[model samples]
Structure formats: C-alpha cells, structure tokens
Target: MQNSTRKRQKEELNYLRDKVQSLEKELETKRHQLMASKGEDKENKAVRVQLRGSRARAMRWQRIAKHQLVEKQRAEMQNLQLKESLMDQIKLARSLQKLLKKNASKKVEGTEAAQLQARLEFGNYCSAASEDSLYESLLRDMDAVYAEVDTVCARHPVMQNMEEGSDVSSLLEGETDALSLEATNSKVVPFGMEETCAAVWRCLSKDHVKLADGTYHSVASSPDCIRAKAITTLRVNTTTARMQMRFAMKKYVEPGRVVITLESASESEGPRDLLHGLKMMQRAWVVIRPVPFEPEDNEFDGDLPSEETIIQLCMRLTPSVSATVLDIPGQRAGAITELLLAAVHRNLGWLFQTVENILMEHDFGATLL
Candidate 1:
C-alpha cells in the first residue's frame, strides 16, 4: 500500500511541470504578435503624410498655370484692339490726302499733304535685283554709322546723358543671362563679321566718312531710330510675309541694364530671301535699363503692374519691294528681330511688326520729306 501511494504522487508532479511549460510558450507568442501589429501601424501613418504633401504641391502648380493663361489671353486681346484702331487712323489719313488734292485753291495744303503722304508710304519700293547693290553698300558701310553714334554721345547728347568711357565695344562684353533662353544661335556663318560692323557705322553716318587712309567717302544716310520700349507702332499696308527680315544679333546684360546690337547678315544662301520685298542689311543697337515696377491708380493700369523701363534704340533699315513672285524655299525670317522688339516694347514693334511698333510717331525733324 505505501509503494502504490508514492507512485501516484510522482505522476501528479510531472503533469503539473508539463502544464506550466505549455502556458509560458503561449504567452510568448501573444507578445510577438502585438509588437508586429504596432510596427505595421507606424508604416501606414508615414505613407499618409507623404500623400498629403504631394497633393498640396499639385494644387499650387495648377493655380499658377491658370493665372499665366489668363494673362496671356488679355495681352493678345489688347494687341488686336490696337491694330484695329491703327487701321482706322490710316483710312482717315488717306481720305484727308484725297480731299486736299481735290481742292484746287489749297496749293499749300496740297503740297504739305503730298509730303506727309510720302512719309506715310510703307518704304521706298523697288525691284529685288535693284536693292542688292544698296544692301551690299549698307553692309559695307555699317561700322561708319556707329562711329557717328560714338561722336554724338561724346558731343553732349540732346536727350540722354552719356557716362564717361562708355563705348560700343564695352557694351559687347555684357553679363550674360543663362536662364532666360534655353537655346541660342549667335553665330554669323554666311557673311564675315567685318562687313556687318562696317555697315553699322555707315548707317549711323549720314555725312561723309574719313577712310582709314584719311580720304572721305560720302554715304546717303537714311538714319532712323528704333526705341525698344516705344509704346506706339507704325502702320503699314504690307502683308505678313513682309514681316520676315534676316539679321544677326549680339546681346549683353547687367543688373538693371541690357544692350542688344543686331546687323543684317544672312545665315543661308547669302540673303537670297531679300528677293521678296523684305528688309535687308538692317542694323540696330538697343540699351534698356529697368526701373521700379509699381502699380498705378487708374482703371487702365490693371493689365499688369506698370514696370518702368528706360530704353534707347539706334537703328538703320532699307526696305525694297519685290517684283518677282518666286517664293523663298523654307525661309526662316523676321522672328528674332520681331520678338526682340516686341519684348522690349515698353518704349517700341517688326522687322515689319517692329517697324510698325517703333516708327509710328515723327515730328518731321531731320526726316527728308
């Protein structure tokens, strides 16, 4: 009886030890599952925060794009309205010219009207073949014109004051703006640089030029000024094709200041595109100084903040009418000069468009009527 009782006690003790071990294993598994669930919750929170940030950026960009589109449309509408107004003014001028001619007793009035009419004429029309010599001549004497520009600035300019030691060459080495334009073509491959410079000088000098060897040569000067920031434009009867002009340009910039000089130089086929009543052998130098941009207190001032810019433009051009109907094959003309003028029109307009933009107003001073 004592042996049987001892055996039963030993079995009971072994069962209690096995039960304790199994309970400990189950408790450890529950702890591990709680830790994993916490880790997954943290990861999900980070993803939600990132999604909110991305959405805010997208909303900001959309607002900016919408604003820009509205501004562009408003600018285009203003341009169209101005064009129509100019056309009306031109028609009125034509009617006045006719009325003056018909009145037999108005001799003085008729003569004055004729001179004004001649001035209003788009350009000196001529055959493409004929203007070649003039274009070449203008190119040959281009630099002489700028030489006069230097002299004029030196001899107490009537309008703007010139700083000491200021010269065209100094303007050439201007600080560059790398971010404004992604790609640029500044190379003049067709004609040599020497000729273009010469033409510019000649364009400026309406008088006789003393050659390098001390001899004087005469140049018939058609000196004209183009203001890069002119608010007005000239009206012409020509079509859009006349807007094409071929030229080379060099630009320089500094803080609040810019200098742009361009000359008529062809890139392909030696300016053969001139056969179509387009401007050739053109040259211009423009200087712009930025002023404070501020808002005005008027109903007309809401298009944009009125930014004041002081601009000075010096230019020379000779336009010849084309008698030939032969079209230029893939002619890339008039964009650079046109866009350059338009961009700068705080003071000016085309080669045709710019011509219209800047050459509109005249007091008949030094202009041969």
Candidate 2:
C-alpha cells in the first residue's frame, strides 16, 4: 500500500511541472507581441514628426510670397499717383499763360485787376481736363515736321552767311578756352546770391514775345532765392497739336564755382517715341555759364569783391530713352546733327532778342540781341 501511495505522489508532481512549462511559454508569446507593438508605435511617431516638418516649410514659403506681392502693388500705386499730379501741374501752367497774354495790352502788374485776373486764371487751369491728347498729336507728327524743317532750311541759305564768314566750330573752340581761364581764378568777386537769383527770375517771368510760328514764349523765374532757378518755355502748334519745350536754368552767384550744365531730353510720348517704338531716342543739352563780370576801378565792397560771371553756349544730341539705342536709322549721325543745329539756329534770333530785353531791364551791361 505504501509503494502505491508513493507512485501516485510522483505522478501528481509530473503534472504540476507540465503546467508550469505551459505558463512559461504563454508569457514568452505575450513578451514578443508587446515588443512588436512598441516598434510600430515608434514608426508612427516618426511619420507624424515628418508631416509636421513639411507643413511648417510650406507655411514659411507662402508668407514670403505674400510679402513680395504686397510690395510690388504698393510701388505701382505710387507711380500712378505721381503721374496724375504731374498732369495737373501742366494744365495749370497752360491756363496761367493764356490769362497773362490776354492782359498783356493793359497795365496789369501790381494792380487789383491783375490780381483778380490771376485768380480767375488759376481756377480755370485747375479745372482744365487732364487729357493730353493735344500734346500727343504734336508728338506723333514730330518726325514729319522735323523733315519739313530740314528741307526748308536746306532750301533757304539762312546759316550760309555765318558759315562763310566765321564758322561756328572756331567760335565754340575760342569760347571754351576763355571759359577754362575764367574758371581757374580764385581772387574773384561774388554776386549777391539773393540779388542775382531774383534778377534772373524777374527777367524770365515778365517778358512775353511772339515768335514767327505764332507760338508765344515766357520765362518764369523761381521765387526761391537759395535755389536760383528759371524756366523758359515755348508753346507752339496749339490748334493742330499743342507742344511745348522748356529750358531750365539754375544759377549760384558764388566765387570758385565752375561747370554749369544744362540738359534737355525728349519726352517719351513726343519725339522719343516717334523715332523708334522698340527703342526710344533722347536729346542731350549743353552747358551755359554766365559771362564772368568784374567791377571796374579796382573796387571792393569791404571784404567782399565784385561779382564775376561766365557765359557759355553749347548744343548736344544724344539718345533720349535708351542709352544703348542711339542709332537713328536712314539718317547719318552727321546729317541729324546738322539738322538739329540748323533748327536751333533758326530760333537763335528770337532767343537773343528775349535775352536782350531781360538784360536791359536788369541793366546787366550786356546784350545778346
């Protein structure tokens, strides 16, 4: 009986061992599954991080694009505003000219009637239409007109007499030499900056001269003395095609000042565009200096010396619009230069007369007429 009891106990122990083994295997399987789940979670986290990074980059680029677009639009709007203001100024100036002409026959200066007329004129000019169709028409026909002028000049020997007697080139060379000498002297006189500027302005502003072409000319002197400035403008072909040209001048009546310059350029809508559409042309201006002046009899105003001035006259031709596009097709450069020079010569007499009248009023002791 004892042997049978012992055998039964052994059998029970074996069954218990098998049960423990099965539990160990089940734990191992669970451990493997947990490890695999942890790996998948890590991969998902990494993918989320990559998506976040891409979204951030896209947003950054979008912001940069938006900023550039806003800046471009702002610049374009500013340009439009500037153009509008310029148009308004031009209209007002034209009206003022007309009013002055109407009152030319009577004594209007410093009078109540003159002041009233000015007020009326200002109002009219301010209300004038901004459309520049009249000006545009003139610009369109510049080429034809230029050609006709050239033909007429060739036919008439107007400059022929001057060419035969004293050629322009020799005269220009001599003047250039004199100007160089005047520029070097240091112990020179100084013109009262304020007085000189005022005088120049008055000379330009008060005169009205009618030209042969039926266009009127007027010079307006700037009131600002520190910046002595004057503008001489010509109005022509108003009925057919309104056109204008301005010669702007700046003067500083101080010693040791050299190198005065004057510039003229073709307005893009006018002669510039007429020459070539793909490329526009421009004109350059020459420098004009005041003829140097010195007081007679070795006079000195205390520490200040008398004023000195130098005068120079030159004409220039260059591309108006494009620096590189200077070639005028079908016309040699020489021929074009000659044509322009002749055009200027034709109007030279009128210019001299205008300057003479202004100088006589100021008693500058010089005359161009």
Candidate 3:
C-alpha cells in the first residue's frame, strides 16, 4: 500500500508541474498583448496631435481672409464719403456763379445804354454836317461805329440771323410800288388857296365821265380813283425810302451787337483746381473697385476706367473756377479768363485719358491673378 501511495503522489507532482507550465505560457501571451495595445495607444496619440495642428492652421487662414474683407469694406466706405463731399462743393460753386451773373448784368446795363445813346448823338452830328470835308470825316467815324456794332451783334445768339450778308434789297423792293403811286396821284394845293374855291374845284372835277367796251365809265377824277392813285406803291416805298436811307447811313451807323468778357477770380485762377479735383475723383473710383490696385505703381492691371467719369469731373471743375472768379471783388473783365478756363479743361481731359490707359493695364493683371 505504501509503494502505491508513493506512485500516486509522484503522478500528482507531475500534474502540478504541467499546470504551472501552462499557466506560464498564458501569462507570456497576455503580457505580449498588453504591450502591443500600449504601442497602438501611443501611435493614436501621435495622429491626434497632427490633426489638431492642421485644424489650427485652417482656423488661422480663415481669420486672415475675414480681416482682409473688413479692410476692403472700410476703404470703400471712405471713398464714397469723399465723392459725396466733392459733389456738394460743385453745387455750391454753381450757385455762386449764378449770383455773379445776375449782378454783372445789372452793373453792365447802364454802361451799355449810355454807349447806345452816345452812338445816336454821333449819328445826328454826322447827319447835320453839310460840307464835303465834314461829311467825309463823319463817314469815317460812322464806319468805325458800325464795325463796333457788328462785333457786338456777332456775340448775340438771338440776332444771329441778321448777319451782314443777308439781302436787304429784296425786302426793300417788295414795298416800293405803293409809295410811288401815292406820290403821283397826290395834288399839291396852293398853300393860300381859299377853302370855298377848293370845294368848287373838287365838285366840278368829280363830274367827268368816259366809255369803255360799250359800257359807260366815269371819266371825271372820282374821289375813289384819286385816292387809289394817291397811295404809294410798295416797291417805291421800300426801294426809294427805307432801303435808300439805310444804304446811305450804313457807313456812319452802328449795328446792334454786344461784347462779352469774363471777369472774376474764378476765371482768372489757374487750372490747378481742376487738376486737383480730377485726381481726387479718379482716386475715389479706384478705392471703390472690388480690388484696389494702383495702376500707376504697376502698369499691368487691365481695369479700364470710364472716360465719361473723367469728362464729368472736368465739367464740374470748370464751373468751380468760374465761381471763384465771381467771388473775387473788383475783378477785371477780359476774354482771357474764359480762354484760360477752356484751355485748362481741355488739358485735363487729355491727362485723364493717359492715366486711364495706364490704370487699365495695371488693373487687368491684378484681376487675372
């Protein structure tokens, strides 16, 4: 029994050793799995860190884009305000010019009227002169007056149709016949003739009669015939009277005309104001564009600015200069002022075109990008 029990114990010890070996194998497998899981966890943490960095970069870019948009909007608003201010200044200038024109008209009226009266007096003197030498001198003076009148009339818009070359002869001939007939039929009664004798003569003269084509006709000088014959023909009245008189006095008479001269600080001032105003408007347009690009800096942006904008800006500037002139007290009157203003405006238009071409080229490149 002792030998059997020892054999059984030995078997039990072998089984225990086997169990321990199996348990060691399981523990080794479980250890390897845990280490692999820890390695995977470490790799996951690295990938998450990379993702977070990428998201931060995206957020930064979005912020930059928003900031640029805000800046562009602010610039556009400022440009609009500047444009409105310029328009207001232009309006005020126009009002000043109107007031000046009214005042100038009133001041010049008396001077123009006095000049007309003096011309009339000179014409009377020429008419009264009887001597040939006096007549020749008067004729020369009259010619000068007529020349002045012609110049004044040329400046007038309404009387433009009454130019020097129009045919006055046709107008005069149309009224000549009536005047001649009147002269022929009118009898000059002796100034001292008694009223009783004149009445008897008229009655006796009226009784005369005549025959024509088998019909009895009045041969006596009837009142109707006398009256009809006494009236002057149109042709005679026009040619021998009014036209002849006009032709005779034309050399010594003044024609109706007036001269205009610009006088004011606005007119006398240089084109600097116009140039400045134009530049301001151009800059304003640039700022308001979707992309603010300076063509002057880089000649490749193809933004073509409208020519009408430049032209309108120049027109606005012109009246402003005129207004400045009106504001100036005791300004001289001369055509030079108007000529200068026109010259400046023309120069500015040329400049605008040149600048526009340059800006267009610049804006085109920027827009393409």
Candidate 4:
C-alpha cells in the first residue's frame, strides 16, 4: 500500500512539471507575437509623422503664394485709380473751357457787356493756363506711375505656366508685352530744329510765310504775328504722323486745341529752347485767344469738308487754321480747349483697353493653372 501511494505521487509530480513547461512555451510564443505587433505600430507612427510634416510644408507654400497674389492685385488696382484721376483732370479742363467760350460770345454793345466779356475772357485764360500746367504735371506723374508698375512687376514673379510634381525653377521663366507697347509709343523729341520747322511750315498755306527754325519773320506787318506764333508753337511738337497729316482728325483733336506737344531733347541741347518756345506760345495764346470762338456762317457750309479733306487742307495750307473761328481771344481759347479734351479722352481709352487685355490674359492663364 505504501509503494502504490508513492507511485501515484510521482506520476502527479511529472504531470504538473509537463503542464508548467507547456505554459512557458505558450507564453514565449505570445511574447514574440506582441513584440512583432509593437514594432509594426512604431513603423506606422513614423510614417504618419513624415506625412504630417510634408503636408505642413505644402500648406506653408500655398499661403505664401496666396499672399503674393493679393499684393500684386492691390498694386494693379492702385495704378488704375491713378490713371482715372488723370482722366478726371482732363475732363474738368474741358468743362472750364466751354464756360469761357459762352461768356465771351454775347455781343458786347454796352459798357456792362464789355466789362462782363472782359472778365469772362480773363477767367477763361486763367483756367486754360491752369489746365495746361496740370497736363504738363501729368507727364512727370506718368513716369513715376510707370516706374512703380515696373518695380512691382519685377518683385512679384508671375506664373507663366504651372505644372504638378515638376521641379519648379526658383526663378520662373516669364515674359511681358509691356515693353513692346512702351517701345512703340515712347515719346521721342525730334533731333533737328530744321526738321521740326519744315514739318510746321508744310502744314500752313502758301500765303502764310514759311517759317525757318519754327520762327517766322513776319513780312506782313499784321498784329496776327503773335497769333501765328502761338498757333505754330502749339503744333510744333506734334507726332510725326499727325504733323504729316497737318490738320487734326476727329480722332486727334483735343479740347481747346490744347495740343500737348512733347519734344525729346537731350540735356546737351538743353530744355531751355523748347521751354522758352512753349512759354512764348502759352503766353500768346492766353493773351490773344482768351475766349472760345463761334462758328461763322461761311465756316460750316452744306459742303462740309470730310475728315480726309480737312486733314489735306491743313497740310496744304500755308498755316494751319485754329479750330475756333472767333476773332476774340476768349472764344478761340474755348474752342481749342474742346478739341484737346477730345484727344485726352481718346488716348485714355486706348491706354485702358491695352492694360485690360494684358490683365485678362493673366486671368485666363490662372484659370488654366
């Protein structure tokens, strides 16, 4: 009985030892699986962190691009506003010229009428001079405006073409049409006085003394010498195309015939001569044609001259006729003012249209991108 009991105890101990060994093997397998799963989780976390960093970089670049775009747009808007202001000034000058013409026209039979006419004429001259000065000021303003535009355009690199996942060059390749237009329209002052004088002389009638060097020595002892000088000087710095044609077409005529003649003289020639001529003409016109002129019965016949005919007449004539028929200073002033204002309007329209087309092209490109 004692031996049987000892055998049973030995069997039980062996069975317990086997069970413990099995549990240990199972625990080891579970630990290996858990370690593998933890390694995989860690790898996934690392990948997720890298993805988050890439997304942040992309977002940062996008914000920078958006800021640049906004700044560019704001600058364009400011330029447009400045251009509009210049247009407004031109319009105001036209209005003032018209008022002066009307005031000068009422027949001055009595002292009161004469005094009123004189006062109105004086006011007209002052206003016209003021307008002219303003126009000259705009020339300076235009340079500054164009410079600003160039600076902005240079700083902000416009996207000519965009691509996805391509290595974009730091300095994008792009081109602009602004330079083409500027090159074509750039004002060049005539090099020689003889060339300028000849151009002016050809526009005047044969009866009108042909001037040498833009200064006509009056053989005809008429008070109209000053008047003639004013008219000649006004047209002196006209564009070669316009000068060749002589008379301003409906398209070219400005209000009050205030032709802003631009001469491109270098510092060597000195601005003195050109400025002196301009001052003399301005003074003469202001003094002589203080009021706007009225159209005479003979001036506008049933057989109205066509634009081409008028242009030819101006070219063929000894001296170009001032648009205003008024013998009085004020009336001529008013008429010329109307003619010049029309020119300003035409030029502004042209400039605006060109700029708008460029912007539209950019917008289209952006849409494609």
Candidate 5:
C-alpha cells in the first residue's frame, strides 16, 4: 500500500509541473498581444495628426484662392471705370474744341463782310463818276470781286466734277429744271469737280430727307414762287435786296457723309397765318456726302479717290402742303442753296485747317479717322 501511494504522488507532482509550464506559455502570448496593441494605438494617433495637417493646408489654399479671385474682380471693375472716364473726357474735349473753332470762324466772317461792303461802296462811287479812268477802275474792281468769288468756289477738294472741263451753268441747267418740276420731293445737290477745276452743281430730287432745328419763317413774292424772308438770326426785307447769309457748317459723320438731322417735321413748322403775302416756313435739312472722283478725273497721290470723298451737298425743303398743292423750285430754295454754297466757300479752308490741327494735337482725332 505504501509503494502504490508513493507512485501516485509522483504522478501528481509531474502533472502539476506540466500545468505550470502550460500557464507560463499562455502568459507570454498575452504579453506579446498587449505590446502589439499599444504600438497600433500609437500609429493611429500619428495618422490622425497627419490628417489634421493636410486638412489645414487644403483650407489655407481655398482661402487664398478666394482672396485672389476677389482682388482680380476688383481690379477689373476699376479698369472698366477708368476706360469709361477717359472716353467721357475725350468727348468733352472734342466738343469744346469745336465751339472754339466756330467762334473764331464767326469773327473772321464778320471782318470779311465789312471789307466786302466797303469795296462795294467804293465801286459805286467809281461808277457814278462817269470818267474813263473811273469806269476802268470800277470795271477792274468788279472783275476782282468776280475773281474772288470764283477762287473761293474753286478750291474745294470735293469739287471733282468741275475739273472735267464741263461748265457749271450747263450742269445745273438740266438738274435745276428737274428740281423746279419736282418740288414736292427731296433732292440731292451734288457739287462735283473734275481734276483741279471748278465744282459742277447739280440738283436732283430723291425721297429721303433729314431735318433742321429751330423755327424759321418765309415771305414769298407769290405762292408759285416762294421766297425766304427771315432765317434764324438772319432777316431780309424788300428795302435791303442784298442776300448775305452765313453760319452754315457741316458736321461730318463717318462713312463719307455729313449729317445735320433736325427734330421731327411736326415740331419744326411755324404758325399757319402770316401778314401780307407770306407762307409759314416748314422743316429743312442738309446732307453732304462724298461722291467718288472718276478715275480719269481723280488727282492721285498714291491713294484711292472716290466721289464719296468728293462731295454732294443737298438741301431739302419740306413744305407743309401735301401732293394736292402746287410745288415748284422757289426763291426760298434758291436762297438756301446760295447760303450753303457761300458758307462752304468761305469756311472750307478754315474747316480743313482746324481738322488738321486737331489731328496733330490729339491722338483721339487720328484714332477716329
């Protein structure tokens, strides 16, 4: 019994040792697992920090982009305002320059009229003397006046039709007849020059008409032959048969036309009734367009010359009467025609000089041209 007891105790002691070894192995495995879990936790913390930094960088860039876009828009708006301001200044300057030029022209015209009046008085004195020398002197003075008139009329660049050796009277005769016959419609009166000669004036009727501003009145000798008595700031009476009209100027529009567009026809007409034999004046407008010079007639300076650069100045008289009434080229029409011709004759040189000066002085003029 003692031997059996000892063998059993030995077996129990071996089993106890095996149990302890198994427990030691399990504890080592648990230690290794805890160490690995701690390392994973540290790695997770670093990943979270890196993600925060990246987000901050992205947010910074987004703010910068937004700021830049705002600044860009502000600069664009400022630039646009500056451009508009510059354009306004340019227009104002141009208008001021034109006003100054017009004033100067008026002064020059007044001086010229005085001199012409003096010369006429002198001529009359010479003719009244009835002596050979006096008569000769008067004749010479009259010739000089004619020469002056001719010289003035001949100098226009637009007078290309006259240079073709055609007489001005002949050119006007047929056109004038047509104008006289068709007084109801509007017309285009062309002033053409051939080469370096005189301008050929031709009046031809057309359909389209622009308008002129300001109220005007007319006194006619007869309804059949209407005559202009009073124009704006200019009046002519029976006592003074002298026809002196001025202050007409052409404002050029682009594409070879100068347009003077007045208010609508209804607004331009005067009162219907007048004392004596007179008719109320109606609307009027003037148009000047460049007609191309014929190739044969053009004076070339290495540039293409068309009649359009040469010109046609037209005056359209819009009477209040309709197709039912009588219409013919009248004295009023003649007066307007004379006024335009004379005004241009006097002012063309001045106009050209002013334009040239403006072109030289300002970049705007060059750019516009």
Candidate 6:
C-alpha cells in the first residue's frame, strides 16, 4: 500500500509542474499583447494631435484672407470717393473762371459791335474791297489743296482730273455774282477720312429736300446734279428763286494720309436765289484730311487737332431780302453778320450730325472710286 501511494504522489507532482509551465507561457503572451496595445495607442494619439494642428492652420488662414478682402474693398471705395471730390472741385473752379472772363470781355464786345454796324453801303452786303481780299484768301487755300493733290497725282498711275486753281480764281474774280467768298468754320470729327468724305458727298448729292425757317424761310431743294469726283445731282428751290447747284469731289492718297477736295462743278455756274438784281454765288475749297495718330498737347488755349478727320464746310448764304432788313435803326451790323453766320453754322452742324447718325444706323460702308 505504501509503494502505490508514493507513485500516485509522484504523478501528481509532475502534473503540477506541467500546469505551471503552461500558465507561464500564457502570461508571457498576454504581456506581449499589452505592450503592443500601448504602442498602438501612442501612435493613434500622435495622429489625432497632427490633425488638430492642420485644422487650426486652415481656420487661421481663412480668417486672414477674409480680412484682407475687406481691407482691399475699403481702399477701393476711398479711392473712388477721392476722385469724385476732385472732379467736383475742378468743375466749380472752371465755372468761376468762365464767369470772370465773360465779365471782362463785355465792354470790348459792345465797342466791336458798334464799329461793325457802320461797315457797308445801302444795297450791298460785301464791299468791292472785300472782293479782292476774299479772292486772295480763297486762292491761297486753293493753292494749298492743289499742291497736295498734284504731289499725290505725280506718283499715281492714272492722272486724275487736273484743273488749275488759278483758272477758278480768275473766273471768280470776273463774276459779278459773288456776294461773299470767304473762309468759314471747319470741324474735326473723330472718324475715318474716306468714310466721312463719302458721307458728306452722299448727303450733298442725294435728292433730299428739307425746309428750314429762320432768316430767309422756305428753302427747298431737289438735286438735279452731283459733281463730286463721284458725280450726282441736286436742284434747289427757295422762296427767292430756283438754284441749279453742282459739286465735284477728288480724292488723293499718300502714305498714312487721305485727302478729299470738294468744289463747284462748273466755274461758270453758281448757286443763286433770284431776287431782283441779286445774284447769289458760293465758292468753296473744302478739304477733308485725316489727322495722324498723335497726342496734340500744345499750350495754345483752344482746340487741338490730333486724331481722326478734319471737316471743312464751304456752304454759305447771301441775303436777297429787302435792304430794309439791315436798315433797322437799332440793328447792329454784328447782329446781321451773326444772324447770317449762325444760320450757315446751324445747317452745317445738322448736315454733319445727320451723316454721322446714318453711318451709325445703317452701317454705311465707305464707297470710294
């Protein structure tokens, strides 16, 4: 019995040793797993902190951008307000200066009017002395135009219609019909030379009749002839008489420059209104030239011609009404001259504006031959 009991105790002791070994192995695995879990937790915490830092930077930059935008808008508003203030001040200063100038010129303007009132005789508007002066001035203008045309023509393959300016001048000198042949106002419109010339020609040549009332009312016209380099016809009917008018145009080209010259088609013929013993004649050396592209900054206080076309109008009117029209006791010669000049100027303005409007509306293409 004693031996059997010793063997069983030995077996129990071996079983106990095996259980202790298995328990040690399990504890080692659990320790390794715990260390790995701590390492993973440390990595996860680092990732979370990095994400928060990035979000903070994003929010800061967004705020900075918004502030900058507000500041830029404020600056623009202030700049615009400053510009408006400056403009207002400039306008006020100009108004005051014009008022002062008008006040200063009033006296001289009165004296000038009085002197002009005593100029001519009973039945005549222009004196014989003015004829020589007018002829000379027109000749000068014609000479300038001829020289320009001849210069361009010499280089041209086809010699365009060549006429001597002197021939026209001599013919004009002999005509008893010229009431006044003088240089009139011109305009420099911002447009192409050829286009504007063509427009002007079209306006003059078309059988367009308009009746205007002013100094001498009821002037109606139907173009029976047009003589610009591009030829057509228009006949005029007025209260005073019937007018047979013709125009001629010539175009010349040079490097970067275009010139158009318009004059009477027939030297022997002039536009007239048949009032008893009054034969009205008009002679013109109107020129249209393109201005070179450049800045015109000359201190000479007037208008500067730098770009686009130069428009010179050569239409005028002679009073065929009774001599009593100017014989009113209170009538100043300045008033008569102003009235006549204003009428001519108004017509010219309307003509130009009409052409410009047509061009804009109809897309009027330039037709040059």
Each model's lDDT comes to 0.33, 0.32, 0.27, 0.28, 0.29, 0.38
Query: After superposition, which runs of candidate 6 have C-alpha atoms over 4 Å from their true positions?
Result: 1-181, 209-225, 228-274, 295-307, 314-343, 362-369
**Which one is best on TM-score?**
6
Ranking of all predicted structures according to lDDT, beginning with the best and ending with the worst: 6, 1, 2, 5, 4, 3
Clash tally for model 3: 39
How many clashes does each candidate structure show, in the order listed?
Answer: 32, 15, 39, 32, 19, 18
TM-score of model 6 vs. true structure: 0.33
Tens-digit lDDT track of model 1 for 1-369: 223222322332343344334434544554555466558657855754564356678678657756865775565555454443233223322322232223222233234333323323323321234435534533544455444444433332321432211111101101210001111111111222233323333333324322211222222333332111112121111212223232334444445444555554221112444223332334555554443443453457556443333344554332222222123342322222222222222122222222222222221332656
Error of 1 at 101 (Å): 13
Residue 195 displacement (Å), model 6: 2.2
lDDT, model 1, position 176: 19
Error of 3 at 96 (Å): 3.0
RMSD (Å) per prediction: 35.6, 40.1, 49.7, 40.2, 43.2, 41.8
All candidates' TM-scores? Answer: 0.27, 0.28, 0.18, 0.20, 0.20, 0.33
Model 4 lDDT tens row, 1-369 = 223323333433343344335435554554565466558657855754565457688688667757865775575554454444344434434333333333334333453333334434333432334433433432343333323332332332221111111010111111210000010011112112222222322322123433211222211222111111111222222211111111111111233221112211100111222221111011000000012223563385766332100001000001111112212221111222222322233232343333334444554777899
Per-residue error (Å), model 3, residue 266: 22
- The number of the candidate with the highest lDDT is 6
CA lDDT, candidate 6, residue 267: 15
Q: How close is candidate 4 to the true structure, as a TM-score?
A: 0.20
Model 3 scores worst on lDDT over the 10 consecutive residues at 280-289
Residue-level lDDT tens digits of model 2 in 1-369? 223222333433343344334435554554565466558657855754564457688678557756855775565454443343233223322322232233233332344333334334323422235324323332343344333322332323322121211112111112111100001001111333333334334544544554433233333444421111122222221212112343333333334322222322222222331222111111211122233344553564455445433222333222111222333332111122212222233333344345446544555554433
lDDT (10s digit) by residue, model 6, range 229-316: 1111221222222222233334455564444454331111222221222223333434566655555444564676534666543333
* Candidates, ranked, TM-score: 6, 2, 1, 5, 4, 3
